[model samples]
Target: MEPVFEFPLSLDKHGPQTLARRLHQQLRAAIVEQRLAAGTPLPSTRRVAQAYGVARNTVIAAYDLLMAEGFIVTRPGAAAEVADLAQWRQMAPRTRTRTRTRTRPAPPPAIDWRKAQSSEKPIGSAATAASARGFHLGLPDHRWFAADVWRRLLLHSSSFALPDAFGYPSAAGRPLLRAAIARWVAYTRAVVCTEQDVVVTSGAQQAFDLLARVLVAPGHTKVAIEDPGYPPLRAALLAAGAQLLPAPVDEYGLIVDTLPADVRIVCVTPSHQFPTGVAMSLARRQALLDFARRTGAVIIEDDYDGEFRYGSDPLDALQTLDREARVIYVGTFSKIMFPSLRVGYVVAPPWLIGALAAAKQCADNGGNVALQEALARFILDGHLAKHTRAMRKRYASRRDALLGVVERELGEWLIAVPPSAGIHLYARYRDRRQAKRIATLAAHHAAGAQPAGDFLLDRQTTFDSGIAFGFGYIDEAEIEGSIGRFASALRGSYASAD
Candidate 1:
């Protein structure tokens, strides 16, 4: 029978070794190593030749050489088989002495990498569901996202083949995309900037990383981050060797009065304070800008979820008020669009744009060309604004539904933190210790519960315990059931505690 086995053999015509000789040597070595054992059938000459992209004569000659050397046996009208291993071993006498080789241990690392590593879990570590259900943070409802429209835009970008489109994209991003972003932000977020001031990033996370690389002086640069802030931004600052100063946040957002005097950089989610859904007060924004101007500190304003406001006019972005260009506005389409899109941008001042562009170039070479082009078309054609408006209405309805459930069902166990904007709302637990316990219970009920301590810089035990409930991801129709499940989970946790 013709044995079916992958011939893990190759031919290199460019080499000094001929294909037939190389094949012979390989087969001989396989037999010696007992890889091709006794009675193991080899593929026919035609099959081996076809598999290796060589002439049939090459395979025939190699097989003949192996047969002549007594490595293989072939009978009339029978396939070639490996000769008995015992016969080959007897013919080739063992003359060499055996020796044992000792392995040396690898040397210890020179640098203390432990200090450079982060002890805290990454952002959205708990949001591991295939689809966002109850209370999953940072996830928008993917089911509502316009997949068809996005597909069309992507195709539109691919349809026209410009010379530059075929090449590697610019590190700063495509000119069209940068322009579109500049116009879009200027109109929507009150972020006044030209295309020259924008540098497209993989996401808001990469924007922070690139900024850290350019602005931080490693081991000397002092950066101030909100106490219960976004983990990724804090981690980025820490990784850049900045001495992180965790500033406290109140109802109005980051308390500028509490900021340390020597901080050279400040990162804040001023639009809607992450996990807390509190917009930074106008007074606080002015104070922050004044403080930045006073100390020459660069403020990184992460306007992640500024577009989903239910009430009140859109607050002026920190970048809009920065007459001195101290505030570097970072925005992402992940929350506004979908997470996997991996498109975000930085509205940087002219002075910092060049350095940031260079840093981006060194990071991933450049952004995805087609993606950038598609996003550019998506923005310029008014699809982005249209989608965002539709999402805002839907998200607002979800917000109302969540608020209703919290007031009616969860009022006894938790108190709402008064959410004004953003996808999630924070609720302080009646019993602080219950915050950690409820998360596991919530999971059993097919839900999610993110503890406030997960976002804290120091993770102090004394920190007030609360849970962030994301309503943007789950449907309005499912809101009642999801909230019921959440209430059940809370009750279960309390029962266990009793």
Candidate 2:
């Protein structure tokens, strides 16, 4: 097979190396070592010749021999690539980034100059001033997804006749998948929208990006976000170069009566408010929509976790209540399926769906089509519905298990804000220092356990000001032990705080 990496042209012209034989051996070694994985495109013939100081004919002969040996596959016109590494079983994810000390001279442009670092800080932290130990507020529980099905779908999709699917995919995203999304939303979220209204996007991040691009006109627009809300939205709004006004929220959710005068976009998480798990009251939903209508502001309904509510029946999505086409609904599969899925959709007003679709097309040409199809089929075939129901039951049980533990063992240590639904709840310790320590202790027990302060900026963000740990991602057996450690950590942390 052709090598996964660029073939070294450094074989000695008159040395003991057989130019062709040496090339074949190197190719074989790379494939065997699993460095040159299957399907990786090899360097061009012209480039290979230039590298080895050999003629193009020599490289071509070597490549042909490799192909003959079933080591590589050469497309008629495209670059020669290694055969699929179907046999290579993937192991553990590289938690630590490995740095290489190379003897070769670095290239001028410096393309491969540095390797990825295993820094404790995430990109989200570096840019937003968010802490690494923040609450599980912005992201979803990735462990709940059926990733194997999607992976199989990816393999099948690549094996299809069309790689790019012959031509430009729909800017609104794949039609079959969109239809699936429409049906899935209808069944799961109880929202009303069709395939025509669904505009596939990178994720809720890009949903905001595309929506902001179309709706918000730099200085002329003002968008309202929850007072103690997602920083990413605030970051995105600021980056979008729009003015952000903090809308007040309380027990029932964002105070509709206190909205600002000139907002063109209003972002809300009616299902479960971030940080504080308050469901928006029906009165509040109507008032918010009414306020939007009166002021002509488009309500940007961030239904990020609306699918996972507890106790009460499904609440009609705010967009369903929009008669004036005022609600721009953004929903994501990241929470329900997996975050890396990066698949979200905006059911824009029918007239404006075209504009939003155009914006999406320009953003990244409608996301990964194969993934979209796989997810679409998954949802359409009822696997998503079946799996979501199963996970909800599991998460709800864990939530209860945690609440029960804290109630019995460490009741005095926290302030509870239990949700009617959603995977996480907020708890506060009177002393902020204690909160940090408890989170550290919790992490010593479990890997990703953390406090809410991590998501907050010292300047703008606000919440109960506590550590937020999740039982949703872990087992019931671990909860009691985790809580015990959490309590011990809190006491020790506070003793030091004093």
Candidate 3:
């Protein structure tokens, strides 16, 4: 039987040592150093020669030399094995010193790593995992996704016949996916753009990060974000060294008049404000556009879940309203399809697309081309729109279930902010002091409710203390039971507080 050798064997043709000599030295060292234990079999000469691209004569000569030195033993029609070296190991001279030197402690790092990680706090309590079941924020019902259809599309897109499918993908993203995104956004969100204006990204987070990398002048750029805004976006901007200014939001959305005049960038969720679920008023939308135009500041419109509105006609996206090319619109499939998909797009002005594409190239060289192609087909085939419509109905039912339960059981203590769109409901606690306590206690009762205070950018800001209940992941049937658990926790919190 052929034997196996795990030790590495190398030969340098140009070196002073001959091929056979070098192989012999390495094998000898491996056996003597105990890397090759006693009785361990060595590969056949032909196998060694083929494996290392060396001649069989060189391997045979090396084996012959080792056998002569009594380091190896060979039998008729059998591979060579390491010799018993127990006596040799005992007689070997000891080289290691008895005393050990003390190792000095490493000096502190120049950059404060703790400060860098400060922005990574979960939207809710850090004790509970963010993706925990029962009302966890920003998670879609992944069970409803059309896995079979997606798999078929993936298989088709990755066909070996298409050479471009295997090549290095475009840094700006695949043309078909970009064009699909342009058409989808234009039809659904009223976003004004063509294929040239779109840049496909891994997800909304990467889109924000790429924009931050390109636009932010480290430590000097002043960027304004909503007080209770998306934390991941905040983290991306902070990593780029932008000075974050927490702008206030009321029922109308971001208070445009209150924004600092010198701010260079404004990031807002105007379609449906995150956590609060308040759609920005048309007057306020116009006011923000005017503000951006007057201050020469760019606006990043995160139309995260704008497609699921249940009430009146949805307002035009900020990108649709922008006439001076000051808006950068970002959208994601995480809420519409599933978070793991990690597909999103950005619609920017023609001039800025180059910088964003370059930044994207530097970040990841581009997203998965095959996946992009499949997603493009998914969009073009109308599967995305169909899936979204079905999920919207499902989410709407879950939303109603959650709202009904919250109003029926916990209405006295929790006053829900009127929700016009989106899958979550934010309710301010009537007693501000007990809101955080209730949210913490609810986690122990298996209800994953997040404190509104946890999302606030400026903790000192005079916003009402509340809780956010996400309905996207929770089933309609389970909503009542989850709310019951949360209610029990609420009563316990009140009892303890009293």
| Model 2 lDDT at residue 199 | 88
User: What's each prediction's TM-score?
Assistant: 0.78, 0.70, 0.78
Position 449, candidate 1: lDDT: 53
Alpha-carbon RMSD, candidate 2: 11.1
Candidate 2 clashes between residue pairs 3 or more apart in a chain or in different chains: 1-71, 1-72, 2-72, 9-52, 310-421
Candidate 2, residue 316: how far the Cα is off, in Å: 2.2
Q: Sorted by lDDT, highest first, which candidate order results?
A: 3, 1, 2
Per-residue lDDT of model 2, residues 304-391, tens digit only: 8777767868677898878898888888987777666778888888878878888877878866777777777788778788778888
Sort by TM-score, top down from the best: 3, 1, 2
Point out where model 2 deviates above 4 Å: 1-148, 161-164, 430-450, 455-464, 493-498
Which parts of model 3 are misplaced by more than 4 Å?
1-114, 118-132, 492-498
- Mind giving the per-residue lDDT tens digits that candidate 3 earns over 258-332? 898999999999988877778899999999999999999999999888888776788888888889999999999
Model 2, residue 428: displacement in angstroms?
3.3
Instruction: Estimate, for each residue in 76-155, the C-alpha lDDT of model 1 and write its tens digit.
Output: 99898999867655533342224588768899664344754555544443345354466678877767677898899898
Q: For each candidate, C-alpha RMSD in Å?
A: 7.7, 11.1, 7.3
- The 0-to-1 C-alpha lDDT of every candidate, in the order given, reads 0.82, 0.71, 0.83
